[model samples]
Target chain A: MRAAIPTLFILVLMILAVSLLGVFGSPLLLRVVIGAMINLVVVIGLSIFIGNSGVLSFGHASFAAIGAYSAAWFTLPITMKKIFLPSLPAFVLSTQVGLAGGAAIGAVTAAITAAVIGVVIVRLSGIAASIATLAWLAIVHSVFSNAEALTKGTSSLVGLPIETNLFVATSAALLALVVAFVFRFSRYGLMLQASREDEAAALASGIPVRQLRLFAFVVSAAVVAIAGVLKGHFLGILAVGQFYLEFTFLSLAMLVLGGMRSLSGAVVGTFAVAAIGEILRILSSGFEIFGVEVIAMPGLREIGLAIMMLLILLVRPMGITNGRELTLPWKRKAANELPITNDQIG
Target chain B: MNFALQTAIDALSVGSIYALSALGIGLLFGIMRLINFAQSEFVTIGIYILMLSAGVWFPLAALAAICVVVVLALVVERMAFRPIRTADPATLLVTSFAVSYLLQYSLVLIFGARPIGLDILPELARPIVMGSVRVPRIDIATIGATIVLLSAFALFLRKTRIGIEMRAAAVDFRMARLLGIRANRVIAVAFAMSGLLAAVVAILFAARTGVAAPTIGLELALVGFVATVIGGMGSLVGAVFGGLAVGVVTVLLQAFLPPELRAYREAFVYIVVIAVLVLRPQGLFRGAAARERV
Candidate 1:
């Protein structure tokens, strides 16, 4: 019954999304939903590492960039693939493996990279780990931006088959949620959480602290890579800018704002921030305050959102929902009655 | 030999600017154990303020820019830091990043995406020649000014009551509180000092580059951060040395390496930083015990 609730919720949301797409049928809105769903997958993955582990991994977006580029290299049409690889493997070049193949390859590549780096990075603790990961992000971004032959430099990679429709994206998001739920309940997840709360104690308790962290980091990278693959297919183009510091900041904001510890919080945060960002962009384009345009205000949305984050931290530092899940009450409580636990009553 | 000399000189100039900006960053980290990601935004804010107020006297504009950044830093401390000071250090770090984005984007909205060139202070930007190599006068000024500012800062730290308070706070905030030192005030001052240093660095950076943009802060911050880690997290002297090392490495790579791979200068720098971090995580000069806080 406990497991069914989350699954049922995701199913309902997916159905609603499809229904909304059928009725409204707006391509732009569909596109936004697709992007949000893809982001949701990566955010859930990040929650497992950052939320449960109590560490920030700044390089997660770098994994996303790797996934996007790797998938694009494999799947984009030959004519549009001149920049990255002039000649590809016969299998990759000849066969137009669709979204699933691209995403899987992306996941594999990201996981491999993460495993290699995690061996070194997972040894470090606290801010050192954060700095190392941040450096990793910068290094990957530099490679993506400068490797003109492969990534076309800053130029966007086009000619990708748009295989990431709302359905695919919604399904990926649902899958991500399930994975997050399973991980949260699993013994490994409990061990990882214990390590996060007290590393010394966990180690004394026989937990392989470094190995656990590395495991979480690799899994997170793989999930983010899959998100990147979906994002590339949905957009039908990939650019370095999509996965750089700006995206990193946006994801961090979403994670922080939504309450990082819960799967539902990740979803709510992604959707809320995405919606707010869209509305802000629209306002900036059209709305003027006292003859001064709002969008012209430089970093208005970011500043406003940042201020909102500050306020949240000030008043309720734990976040909007304090890492709590939203659920329908299974047992009913009588009106005007105060329920008590047996221990308290005794 | 001439090429090497030129590269060294060029590196020194850039290194001086980095050192100036990094001093603030190092101090903030030393006292609060938090990396102020918005430190770069303070540089951007300073540059834009100078540009916006260029119609006034150049010195006055520079002064106003510094003052504005200091005030902004204080505001950030009060609104952002004060609230989250009790939260986990990771949360404080993320908050700082959010503040950085907010400041950068706000500047973009206000100033537009175009680069703002501050040509009003041409007198401060005149070039100086040394035998075969020509160096910008502003570069010389930046190096000289950094030396003067740092010397003065060292003196202040050695002599002043507030400086002692700041040192006490940095040594141990809890102990400082027990000793009746106002840790909050000291932290606020540290941020303002950092902002002031960022303003100075921005003016020099803009003078050399001829333009300032919103994105400049992030790149410079990365360099400063690399320098900070290389120098050791909380050591001001280490930051200065680290900045010089980074600048020299970049310039030497540009000068000595084949033309084709010059663009890989940043990557080379990253490798060096990572190598240094792996080998000596406490920094070359900082003691092993310094690793406990950062």
Candidate 2:
């Protein structure tokens, strides 16, 4: 009964969002909504590892990149894809599968890469882990940038079918949210959090810390791959640089700004930041200040984002949602009766 | 042989700059256990300062640039870092990232998106011809400066009472406090020293490339970071050796690889870094137990 509230609310929200997209029918708004939804998947995926395992990963975007290129390579029209994969398998060449197949393949590829890299990376803890993950990001970036035959090098690969509509994106986000929530409540999540909070104690309690981290890392990579597939389709293009430092930073910012530990926080943070970013773009196009032409406001979005991040860090470091999910009144009533300890709250 | 020698010299020059940059990053991490993502911005800040003060005497401009970076570092420490020193390391990491983005975009706001070339001293920028091979004078200067700064830094850590205290604090802040070492003062000094190293690297990097962009620091920071990891995280001497090794490997890859595949140099270097890390997670050199001071 307690879990039913969130599921109902999510269903309503998803229906309402799709209805709005259908009613408005503006390509730009559709793109923005789809982009936000896709980002929700990635952010929630990151939450599994970063939020639960308490290890920061700077290389998640690399998995996203792998997912993106993989999908593009498999799905794009063979004639248009001649720039990258000239000699493709007839199966990949003749048949263009739906978004699900593309996304699934992307997830598998990213998961495999993460599994290989996580073996070494998950062994390190704290700042060392952070640095090692960054190294992984750099390594992946170099590979994508140089592998012209596969990624079309730095050039934008065009001609992806515009298959990622409101339905696909919303479905992916819902799936990601469900998965993330399930993980959050499971024993695996509890053990990962315990390890994060007190590694030695958790180890003393017989938890295989490395194995748990590796599990979270692989799962996160797979989920983020779905996000990457959606983003590629939404944009109708893929570039190596798009998946590099800039997107990595943006995704990290969203996770941090949204409460890292909560599924709802991931959703809210993605929409909020996406809206903020879009508004900044609009303002930079139209508004002016102190006789300065605002349309040419260089790096305005980044500056605004930085300021927002700084304010959030200073004022409410736990994030806007603080890991609390918004649910139906009945759930709230039930939750009120429970003597909630601080341990269960955050 | 000449090509190999030239590559070796070029590697040494680049390695020296990386070593300088990594020294700052390594020292900061050693003391606070906080990876300041904003350290790259300090390098960018120093370069911008140098560019702005180009009309002045070169040495004076350099000094002013270092001072500016030191002051900026102190401000960041006070405003961003000090408040969150007791928080989780993740919080500090995120805050440092915010600071980095803030600095990068602020520069973008002020300077626009164009890359600016620093007007380095002509003598420093000129190439020093030697037999069949020629190396830039800035390379020589970078090597010299790195050696002097590292030596001075080692001496500071060994001979000075404050240095001892800072080392002690780094080992364990609570224990250092129990022993009456001022942790705040030690951390501040680390920031200042980090700033100073950033300034030195900035000058050398700008002189070598003749261009300065806000984004350049991120790449240099990556190299420094890899080197720091390859060198034991807390060991200063290890950072130097790791920096040199990374530089040599990158140069050797470029020299040996076919022209068509030369662009893969960085990728190869990253692979090497990953392999080294997997083989020796603790790094090549682990420092002996040092008293915690900072």
Kindly report which residue stretches of model 1 are placed more than 4 angstroms away from their true locations once superposed: A1-26, A82-91, A285-300, A325-346, B123-126, B287-294
What are the per-model DockQ values? 0.35, 0.44
The DockQ-derived docking category for candidate 2 is acceptable
Give the C-alpha miss distance for residue A319 in model 1, angstroms.
1.9
- What is the DockQ of the complex in model 2? 0.44
How much does each candidate deviate from the true structure in C-alpha RMSD? 5.1, 3.9
Error of 1 at B75 (Å): 1.8
Model 2: fraction of the reference interface contacts it also forms: 0.51
Report clash pairs, candidate 2: B166-B294, B167-B293, B168-B291, B168-B292, B168-B293, B169-B292, B169-B293, B169-B294, B170-B294
- After aligning candidate 2 to the native by TM-score, how far in Å is the CA of A172 from where it should be? 1.1
Candidate 2 Cα errors over 4 Å, as ranges: A1-28, A87-91, A288-296, A323-346, B258-260, B287-294
Q: Mind giving the per-residue lDDT tens digits that candidate 2 earns over B141-237?
A: 8888888988998899999998888777655666678888877899999999898888888888877777778887887787877788788777778
Instruction: Tell me the interface RMSD of every candidate, in Å.
Output: 7.6, 5.1
